[model samples]
Target chain A: MRTMRLNMQNVCLTMVLSLIALGGCDRQATVSTTSVGAASGAPDAAPARKLRIGVSIPAADHGWTAGVNWWAKHASQLYPNVDWSIVSALNPEKQVADIEDLMVKGVDGLVILATESAPLTPVARKAHERGVFIVNVDRGFLEPVADIFIEGDNKAFGRKSAEFIVEKLGGKGSVAILEGIPCTVNTDRVEAAMAVFARHPEIKVLGRQPAMWNRQKALEVTENMLQQYPKIDCLWASDDDMALGAMQAVKEAGRDKEMFIFPGAGMKDVVKMVMDKDPLIPANITYPPSMIATGMHLCVSVLSGEREKIMQYMPRHLMIDVELITPENAKQYYFPDSIY
Target chain B: MRQASTRVLSLTAGGWAPAAALILVITLGFVFHGDRAYFNWNTHRDAMRQASVYGILACGMTAVILAGGIDLSVGSVLALVSVAFSMMSLHRQDSAAMTIPAALMIGAACGGVSGALIAFGRIQPFIVTLAMMVAARGLAKALCGGVKVSRYIQDADGRYIALPVPEAFSRIDARLLGGNIAVVTVIFLACVLVCHVALTRTTWGRRVYALGGNEEASRLSGVPTRMMKVSVYALSGACAAVAGICQAAQLQQGDPEDGAGYELSAIAMVVIGGTRLSGGRGGIGLTLIGVLIVGYIEKILSINNVPEYARLMFTGAIILAAVLLQRRWHPDSEGRG
Candidate 1:
């Protein structure tokens, strides 16, 4: 009886080793087959149902875009099951191609920051047609393709900046305008400022020029304008970096006494200047780069079955409030540690 | 009298002509806008100062062009060097002496890689540098983790801290002579001088010109063509790196995306400087002129209240005009081809 039991045990051990070897082979085959299947569009039987999210954004060619990229990456890390892919292109045509590529990759949802309105509307519409959830960030699209549109109220930004200048100059001072990139945000800001400036005809606009969101360009432009308008009371810049350049020019020209510069965008540097009550930079408008986080939140909500609460039938345009960053509230906007 | 008159005209034609033209335009601009205060010494100085960084990069680019090669990676190299320098400076706050050299070395190393690929790997300068541009930018962005790394001050206890420098350098920057001139401006001028000497006075310089003028002949003449090609790119890389470090120091931060689209500007400056894009000709002096022209036009436009879009259009037009002039001057050299 003992000899028979020893033989049986040896047979059992051999069977177990063969099973382990077969299992190893099975895993290798599975990996290669899955890769091949993905390439050939074979339907996966126990498909890993990943919640794929597409992030469409402008190229990180500037500070704001850099911030957007940072926030998007941060948001992606917070969700594990969701596969996040980022595609950044500077122009509308490239952006559209990126969107189409994402669609082919079979994403469940998308987060878009359009480079322009009309050029991106069709792209958003196409994504919506394919029943993909869409969340628009910053710049808006013309068509009602987005389930949620998140952006700052640029008009308010303009009005607030203008109001500060009018109040500071006692509603009667010569001011020059430094416009941002030509877009809806720029147009809205200009229109809003115009509305306020129209009320106070005494506040003469010495010269309005576009700084193109470049510091050196702003410096040169401001210097030239300063030369042209020697008696200027204040300078209104659409962005903080440009305002910084303008202030530098004024200081360099020894005309600090004749100029007060207020730039928008509430960049950390500008907020710091406001907090310190820098004479040349007394006030600025707040438009945070973190609105990208809101778009990501909406996108996640839709993918995670909170779709009804997040999605609206009409294009849901969200206008984030802009705070006029002066000495009083500058501390609130001052993030010394923030990258922006 | 006739000979003296021709000499005066040639002198003016070479340098003073463009300078005079720029001055005349500013004067005309001032006269046209009678009540406007656009033409002044300070404005001109500020414009030139702003253009100095681009000027330095273009000076290096002119050398590369003269050697019958192109470097699209200069801008990316600049961004990387700037980021590397800023990070090092912040990390090793106690070792201030090592910061500048270390930053320069990092730039040289990056440039050396591009040189190796072009010279030894038998890669086309355009393709190699293009890849370097994309890769360097990716590396820079990755180094910062795709965020703007702001200037931070270290505490006495050797901890990182935030300190805004908007006013920190104002007093220093304001001073003349003993005052802190923007290191960038000084470095730019120094680079121009050094490049001038290297191109005109050195044996290596002769080889660079010979190679650009005729690579096959240079090879046959035993000029060590491969080494020369590598050295030229490495030099361009080093210059870019210096520019990057200057940009970071001035901005008080290392921005991963700071030098975006700057390679084109650098190339434009070189091309406009009357450097034959086909290579083997042109000098740094012409690059300075090109830089001045670009800087002045931009300054003048902004001073006149031109919109941002218009400014871009204007810059494009000026670049086109400069290129046209270059082509007209060198009909046999199809630089674009």
Candidate 2:
């Protein structure tokens, strides 16, 4: 009878927590709706100051960009008073064109994820000159154009993955590298890993290949590397999805024993593999997709007149720390149900 | 008579050189890297087995090109069918007797839709199929709820059941023959045989060729040009669906994004196989060779430690070079002769 009473209490507590979570989501949604409606000029009757919000982002060719789109849309829903328009492009030139278009659209605020640094600086500066609120996410421009910058620490992600690999391999083994798309993120991570590798000359980098953040391509490339190299002790794939493909190739070749593959994105499957202490994939580094939420939160804070804390002069770069995910701590990162 | 013999000799030479080159390259790769444990028989066999999926798609593409129409929706159709098949299998909770047939039927249905649009709508095949490429992807994403769906069947005892393989087709995919030889290879070979017969022996095949050669003349001759176009597109779509299902089976997941950018590759393969993009004049045999060339090049590059971006650049260069070669080999150009 006592046990049953305790069980009821536990269930009730869970219900209350769930309700609170749901309530939070509801508030966010409501905020988004009103904000988006007001921005679009939907029947709000106070001599309206039309605040045009311009969103410049990368096209949804991959998962991270898709998440960015989702977050931007959600933010629009929350801030209905601001007129929001989004332009997504793949290349830097097109992104610059998009920014120029938004500038012409007379946007009051500009949120941009530049495809590159140098080419987009002038465009961002031009937008700033027009008195637009610049919120830069992930990739920053060459010059400081945005008042606030939000992004993950790619160098830290690389360092953590390298540390995990070194520990697992007992500080010595041949490691191959699979890089992401060529960019600041890719170069930073590679440099970070190389720094870690420098500490141990015994850990030779047998091969380094850019998988271009593609699974099939990575799979084929890894397969070929496996054929060429007699034994590869570790594979440090820069991203989780590419790592997954490399893992598949290793498995297909029946070389699971000799390989230890770890990628830096905290994708759910990799987290699961870490939790289970999967032989081939024993660790991963957290590069959360929820960084979009961080960007959205910053945008809200700035709009809500909490600008005293928000640096508005030069681009304020924010680097989120990367968490090492291993068997002991894998549960913290596991979301069996996350779309990412 | 002498001129006819010379022409036949040249045509054979044109076909056989690539074939001979392929054999020579594989032989060299084997001799240099060949050991019982290294570049073993299984390695080459596996490569060929995997290449068959693209080979099959190229075959269908070759046919559509011969009829002077392009179907860009084939890859999209494949994605749709794979998703539909996996979803159906998951819902049934069994890989029972009906699963394979159900998958095939779904593929056929998708093909039928694409065919109807091309044949009756009187739209440019490029435009119609381009719309299909997007719409089919949207449909697949919608059906699968924009997530990768894995199909795993558990037995009564709760152990996971082994993937279903038809008994008659098991030997073709045997590990000894190369664990990579998929049932898709057999299907592709059968498709090539049937298509060859239809193109060479059947009245419909001759009509297709005639229509492609001269559309207005064929129309004047009372050929059902519209029906043939529709049928060929439908056939292409079906082939894509088959490839998709096979791929999904191999991957053990129904990915909405599966076969992304595959249409471009298929088109490239067809064009490289010596098919004219302006419509008509190609065969499945050449497409097979094209698939082999592409598959071999990719395999060789990866083995050589080339970076992914460089590999893409290389593929693009090869494709451009092949197209240039085709232009140079244009029958009307007397310069080559």
TM-score for chain A, candidates 1 onward in order: 0.81, 0.80
lDDT agreement with native, every candidate: 0.71, 0.67
Error of 2 at B72 (Å): 0.8
- Tell me the spans in candidate 1 whose CA falls farther than 4 Å from its real position: A1-340, B1-37, B152-161, B164-175, B178-181, B335-337
Off by over 4 Å in 2: A1-340, B1-17, B20-38, B94-97, B152-180, B331-337
Supply the TM-score for candidate 1: 0.48
Worst 10 residues of 1 chain B by lDDT: B2-11
For residues B86-200, could you state the per-residue lDDT of candidate 2 as single tens digits?
A: 6765554445356667666666666567667777887777888888889989999999887655543346764444444333223322343334344656777787788767766
Model 2, A1-340: lDDT tens digits are: 6566445434533443343234334434444533444444455565555566677787766655665666666666665566566556665544654565455445667778876664466568767876777888888665566788877888888887787788778898999899887656887888898899889888888888888887887898899899889989998877777888899999999999888898767777778888998988888888776666566556655765645455545247788888888899999888665555
i-RMS, each model, one decimal = 32.4, 31.3
Q: By summed lDDT, which 10 consecutive residues of candidate 1 chain A come out lowest?
A: A33-42
lDDT of 1 at A73: 65
Question: Taking the candidates in order, what DockQ does each have?
Answer: 0.01, 0.01
> How many Å off is the CA of B221 in candidate 2?
1.4
